[model samples]
Target chain A: MSKNNSRKIKQSVFIILMLTPAIVGFFVFYIYVNFKSVVMAFSFEKGGETFYGLDNFIRFFKEFTLPDTMFKDTILNTLKSFLSTIVIVYPVSLIMCYFIYKKIVGYRFFRCLFYIPAIIMPTVSAVLFKYIISMEGPIDVFLMRFFGRNVPDFLQDGSLAMGTIIFYSVYFSFGGNILYFGGAMNGISQEVIESATLDGCGWVRELISIVIPMIWPTFSTLLLTASVGIFTASGPVLLFTQGGFNTYTISYWIYEQMLENNNLEFASAVGLSCSVIGFPIVMLIKWGLNKIGDKVGA
Target chain B: MKGSKIKRSISQRVVFAVVFVLFCIYAITLIYPYIFAFNAALKESGRVFTRDMVSLAKPARWKNFVDVFGEFVVSDSGYFKMTWNSVWYSFGGTMVKLITVTLSSYVVCKYRFKGRNLIYNTLIFTMVLPIVGSGPAMYKLLSDINFIESPMMIFTFAGGLMDLMLFAYFKSIPWEYAEAAFIDGAGHFKVFYKIMLPQAMPAISVIFIMTVVSCWNDYSAPILYMNEKYPTLASGLYSFHERIRYSHKHPIFFAGALFAILPPLAIFIAFQNSIMDKVFLGGLKG
Candidate 1:
């Protein structure tokens, strides 16, 4: 074992040579880039960036302390959509996943149909959604008859835009999540399912008790990733609102800062703070889910 | 008891029927858009402008589809250039991802180097640590380094999700194959390319399809990084949308979208078996 270990160390030069590209990439992309973000977050760069001792952070917190600022709206918007993802989107998709897994009536056709959109460019789906939901589009025409005149532009109205975005997101959420949970359920031995059935377990009971517990890793993984969506998900906000009409997200804030505003220092500050705050929350959610899984599995 | 069993079955049938109907409605919502978009893409501008929605085909004017591809893509260049760009992006991006991921994961799996766990853990750690801040920093780095047009940014380290799965995949390969090659005086490169890389083909294929589809569809990256000199299919389509959005000609818009969707859609439909093999095997770990 010691001889093998020494030889492995001797091959360390070869290993280093093999790993050069990725290592350099990791340093340049991950380390150096993140280091700059953190540095810029601390420093105020509008008038020649210098370390200003948390002034940028202070400015962000003070400004976003306002109930209606862009920063506040972005954070709020991210939360609303992310919450919907957790509460509404995931559960609905999980149910869809369950049905698909069970091969419930035209599953293959339905699976292909749903999953195809995910593989297709989001640009395509975004265009399609925009086509239908635009002012005086099909939905508008249908609703125009109901209200008889002046139906709300679903993607334009401040009150309705987030809902529209969420709806579109949930509409496509069926694609990957189904394949995933289906794959997980497929991993479960048929003998287990058959024995459960023979023991007088119905589909619902068996799923809740046997299948879900078995697929805990997959379930928790999806849940945890979705939890992190609070910081990351910017779905159709870019298309729908362009960070306007009370639809800014943290991600959109970062984007708007870069493209529209060119205030990278402030964007860095906000972005850094979001991740710093978000990291613990994400970890908590993951830990809590794992704990629950342990209890349920037990 | 017999009556109870029958009642139970009757209720089950009703439940099944309800679920089926619900799922059918859901499936229609998912699929009907493509059908609508296809027919709309074949319509005349005059028909599209009509307020009345009609399912009846009014002698399908196929010119809209052709015009969308030929006439008004981003700038004077048409669909062909953008198609080439899309091909470059996906092909280049997938190649880069495979090389970077396969190499890095290979090292971690095969080597007993110090900091292997640290590198692996850090990569996993960084996945959840939102890199929104890094966008502008990266933009600065790219623009300053003059690699915005180079597609070198796409070649950077990745596999935030795939890292562990791929590591496991590489580790699962019998080390004897590599050892045999090494004993025959095969260098690391020879052994990796010849023995190990081919062995990791299933996982690599999953990563390939994912990266290609994503790179093909990804609009934001090129729009952010590259100028009109290197417009990808996705970014080109987006730019065209900006130009033609107010034209109120639904057919052309639908045609452009359909054009953009076709490649990735065709790829998915064609290679679904392999895609399913990965998804079923990997279980959407990403």
Candidate 2:
């Protein structure tokens, strides 16, 4: 056999060996499941995967178009939760990261404290917060002692639950992003910043001109990912409130649907229907952000 | 002008100190939950509701820890077994992950194979697509396959994000080392497993730690699919919480939560630098 032919055979064999796990994983985990899901979206779980012929889709739509339907609140709340993090977590983390990056007094201490929550179980964190905010918990205890009156029940009050959930999310979301941004900031050569300092750049000016511009790539990367986070952000609601009190994000709604005695197909259909709306919105936002970032050259 | 500038500078320093103090206060707020848990877990049992949460009792209720572990002993709901299950899941999943990520990534980065970009782009496309309601579908598939209870499900699913990062990391590695290894009569397997894998260790380790931490913390998937028989530490802890919420005292639950959190916390502290810093860099710098 010719040497080149033998080498070609060897290469082909190697490629197959390398690609098998990925191919299998894709088929088993992603493709097959998704294909089945798309089909399941057209069926009813109550009837044991019996064909429903867009009935589920119509039900999903009715959930939005009709008043007192669930789909509207869930999708809206999901976006609201995502936006809350964007408003609170994104900037605060950047600022906190800047402080840590500057190696401010006790920055190391603060960094560890901030990052610890990201590693702990979200459920565990939720439980901690739940205990703290419960009627008999610290928040009430503190308020009753100091102010001679207790605040409204946070977890159970329909009005306060969403805010409480958002607070929990934003609080925990801080450290990981700060670590990411701080790491990116650390990548900026010290000489660049020191030279700016020598040139008498104030903190605000340095942050605006040098830091933001230099870290633009990482910033854009995170921003683009945040667009995808729109659909993904449910904010530990499963553990927090079990998605009750007007707090059911789409993710939680689907989780709740699946847990029902006869809603697996209904859950699959609702998920598919939401994705139809959410997927395009996410993609559009990602594209819009990318264009803006590139045009700004940030 | 000079006097005004000095005055301005002194005021700025004062402002900075005040801001630092305020930040310290804010940081306490961020950390207050854990502190409250620790204090509550140690305080005298009946006083948890009445006493200020921040105060540490003279004789700490260390029996909280004993109660948590001991309660698990009388029942089939084994916290130790669940933790062991979590360890097994992390281990087994990470092993499968190293294969799926490292091998495919090495191939994608190295070989000029047919349809390589197809493989790569397929991954990117799937990632951007919203997987918002993918659970029921995945659950159905797993159930259909009779594989719902096993830990292997967790292993195979670590593909998308980790693979993308691994591909980028592998691409950045210089090809000269592989060439040298090949010249020394090493085959494809040796070049991948020995040469490339070691070089890719830093990036790989970051993903490994991430997978380990995430698997240890996961509650839903195990609870959803694994049923009552083989719950992970997370789901097991969750079930234990629900079971004992009204029955057990607050200290016991707090101790259980603290124990549940400890392993991942240790892992995070150990790898805080690698994860927070190098992970973003490694995962993104493609």
Error of 2 at A280 (Å): 2.8
C-alpha TM-scores of all predictions: 0.91, 0.92
Most accurate candidate by lDDT: 2
Question: Which stretches of model 1 miss by more than 4 angstroms?
Answer: A1-10, A46-51, A142-151, B1-8, B46-57, B156-162, B183-185, B245-249, B278-286
Candidate 1 C-alpha lDDT tens digits along A1-298:
9978865665876788767767777777778888877887776654564655788788888997876667766777788888887887667777887777666667788777778768877777877777676655666666677877755677777888877887888778767777777777777787787787788888889878988888888888788877666677768676666766677788877876777538788788888888878888888987899798888883
Q: Lowest-scoring 10 consecutive residues by lDDT in candidate 1 chain A?
A: A43-52
DockQ result, candidate 2: 0.51
Report how far residue A128 has shifted in candidate 2, in Å.
Answer: 1.0
Flag regions of model 2 displaced more than 4 Å: A45-49, B1-15, B43-59, B73-75, B155-162
Cα deviation in Å at residue B55, candidate 1?
5.9
Highest DockQ: give the candidate number: 2
Per-model fnat list? 0.49, 0.53
Candidate 2 chain B weakest lDDT stretch, 10 residues: B1-10
